[model samples]
Target: MPETLNVQTRDDFGKGAARRIRAEHQIPAVLYGHGMDPLHLTLPGHETALAARNSNALLELVLPGGDSHLALIKEIQRHPLRRTLTHLDLIAVRRGEKVQVDIPVILVGEPTAPAIAVVDAQTLTIEVDALKVPESIEVDVEEKEEGYQLFAGDVKLPAGAELVTEAELLVVAVQLPRVDAELEAAIEENEAAGAELGADAEDSEGESTEESADEE
Candidate 1:
């Protein structure tokens, strides 16, 4: 699900130091695991960004005093206006350890009919062995007909992963798309008619102004 990462400890904190760290292409983060004191660290910005591109990425951290730890991304903060990472929080995990994480649901295959695939849920939370979390959950809908509905229970789970989501959670459904298309066409036609009416009103006003000038 995730890749390995190596990080170093940071001695500084607060705004000014964070700005300097970001300027140096490093991300400020806090690492906590096994009930140990939180360690403030700075990670290589490019590597961290690449690792975080995946969902529920697992990280292998090499800390100070020659200590090494395993963890997973728990939270991330981004710049409000810029495309930079601001802060990160990581939770410690062990190999084969079970942890709860959200995995994205991916739609696979296509329906035979003109049915629109509706994704009722984008992500599902599950209890998975730390290293066993799937990058994504794939649902094959190939050759499926319209009016087919899929629920959370319908999703195939990988080994050692248990669904923490509610059974009633709707995963996806296939339905006809004609109704939406018809509504969009109607709206476009009405807009065109309104534009034509507005042009006619303007022309009439111009004609009246010309007649008044001629009489004068």
Candidate 2:
């Protein structure tokens, strides 16, 4: 679901103007798309920040003049030190239209014993309905054995969703746990050999002393 909120339109521009907007606890934004000129906007910081948590947040933007538009939060720039939003970008969209979005990919269930599921792709690109974007896509790995794999094209998409990623791209990799036990074993064997060498050296010295005494 999407969120609906009223926002103030901004006529002011430039660095100083942007700084002033931030001082008021608002985020300066530019709305683009649908072949129209970009509109400058000032959004409430608290509400915008909350909505920005969702990567594909659909915004129902209401302007001061009572005009409204359906937009997607395209991009967000954050302040490095404060970790707050400095600017935002919005792209206008219409209902029933297809929009390209990168949705999070999640791995569910455990693979068979000695095998682990590793997600190679964090987010997957797909074209889905603008109004009905899915939260995330899940990949199942239960009872999967080593060498199991899931490619981007093989993933099941939501209804009406089309994969935009390369078909041959690997999405998940299931393989046996990588371990190195030979090195440790080799070190232990070397230590045992060293101990035997030391014992033999000590015994040789004792025998030499005994031979010297016997000659004396």
Stretches > 4 Å off in candidate 1? 182-185, 188-216
lDDT of 1 at 198: 100
Give the lDDT of residue 51 in candidate 2: 90
lDDT of 2 by residue, 1-216 (tens): 679878999799999999999999999999999998999999998999999888789999999889999999889899999889999999999989999999999888999988888899999999999998887899999999999999999999999999999989999999876554667788899999999999999999999999999999
TM-score per candidate, chains pooled: 0.82, 0.79
lDDT (Cα, tens digit) per residue for candidate 1, span 109-165: 888767778788999999988987778999888877899999998798998789999
On the 0 to 100 scale, the lDDT of residue 183 in model 1 is 98
**Number of the top lDDT candidate:** 2
Q: List the residue pairs that clash in candidate 1.
A: none
